[model samples]
Target: MNPNPVVAIAGATGAVGVEMIRCLEERNFPVKELKLLASARSAGKTMKFRGKDIVVEELTEASFKGVDIAFFSAGGGISRKFAQAVKEAGAVMIDNSSAYRMDPNVPLVIPEINPEAALHHNGIIANPNCSTIIAITPLWPIHKVNRVKRLVAATYQAASGAGAAAMEELEQATRAFLSGEPFEQKIIPHPYPFNVFSHNSNVDPETGYNEEELKMVKETKKIFGDDNIRVTATCVRVPVLRAHSEALDFECENPITPKEVRDILAKAPGVKIVDDVSANYFPMPKDASGKDDILVGRIRQDISDPSGRSIAMFVAGDQLLKGAALNAVQIGELLVR
Candidate 1:
């Protein structure tokens, strides 16, 4: 194997940033040197990596100087401002923001399905939206054999996708609601504690779907290499802290039965079939939290379209793992290799 490259992390103190560090250590990615970069406000913070205290440095255009790979979990504005600079400095960028996702030149990647596309990157590789990532990992294997024709999905997302502040907001709001306070809500437009609502992004007038839903439909189709698949999604913000769960109803070109779907997904990489409804053993947010694999459960025949080609299932995955940081790091691994 080629020698490990010097890796740098932008937004080193954020939620996904912390998980990125853990994932790097967990997967034992070749790392000759590790650099942690964050905002000027977080410059003096100290974070442990591989048993060593790694000091956080303020991210600058010059931060990519000796770095060969940079994983960016910063917001879109920071990514738009600095990603190209990092790339120009000779480091490949794996960005975890929506900034470059829709760019025709930038590949929105899911390694399980499209690792090959990472090689064609000019500078940055885009990580798909969190909800989309969790959904597609399990959906792709079935799509490969049966070919999904259309889907109607409803997402139950955790607070982590909105970042650390949002997680904190949910917590604080929950406490406030329990204590009979006004139940202040800001990170999410609706009351988050014990309540679920549509995604906060602006709604599309025609489809009435939020931006997150649109991303799921568009990104899923792109990552699966199928433009003909029609997907309509309703992304919801729920009280869960980590895993994102989706109730998916799929119409496939090839006929599909529950047993075949189970068998196909059971052998699929990056997926775990947890569908035993009689035992209440299907995927749950709490059980799926902190794990990398997407869990599928509650499998059944869709009554509306019981043609054997149409089916419904539920899936849950760690939004921060397979959805964001891990996927970005996997892209980096693919690029470096």
Candidate 2:
């Protein structure tokens, strides 16, 4: 990799793609050149990077030429279509889609957790699912200390996970609801004004788990490199516009205390402690939006477990940043180093 690499952002005009641009600039990533690639519909549009407007180009197989590092925020289909081209062009692709996450050859990486896994990538490194990243970021510290045995998570996902269009639909639906005007939701499956629904991903008939929930379970084990860890999740799509919140309950291999958990997280990279019981304030989506650190609070020992090995906590993180763009950028930073 070049000391200053030419970075290409696939799907540059989308929500996560836009945040990728911001992260690269805010973090002062050593970018030699920036190429913005999107569908033909978004081509010719200009997006700002380092006080300059870079024109968006139609993505093609030829787009990876001269690109040393490619950040892909496009959907799985697009990532799959151009992956070989990126490999052939000799660019390292840090993909933000689920397309290659589970592939044995590709590494699913969260820089804070398992950065060393990224160095062995064949050509593409996959960013974990948004909900998976949020739940696991704080857990990695705890798992390292106590060896998590089981983890159950309920995610409060925002519209941003769906896409930029879904976020716009959420805002529009809220306005229509307030005005008592009939509105049709086009992006999301359910009404987004002030409603919550099960994640829209298709559910498995045998297991009754949606695609999002399955990703959490499988990705957790894969990223942690511990298939023995038990995991389950119920993913919900809330009306929030950005950031994702999660309620996590986990049991460690040995007895663990809340204070011990707090101590571990205090030193964990990419985590912020927000556990203040008296003031009744904990991690909230409003406070977490736009922040790179995952806010964690509500730390307590689970009363249900008499054995004293279980703990509970609540966490929030910007779905588009740490969950997607910033994570990909962090991986890029690792490669450049």
Number of the top lDDT candidate: 2
lDDT of 2 by residue, 4-77 (tens): 99999999999999999999999999999999999999999999999999999999999999999999998999
Q: What is the per-residue lDDT of model 1 for residues 119-233, given as tens digits with 9 covering 90 to 100?
A: 8888888999999988889888888888989999999999998899899999999999899988667777888999998888889999888899999989987788788999999
TM-score of 1: 0.97
25: Cα error in model 1, Å: 0.5
Model 2 misplaced stretches (Cα beyond 4 Å): none
Question: Highest TM-score: which candidate?
Answer: 2
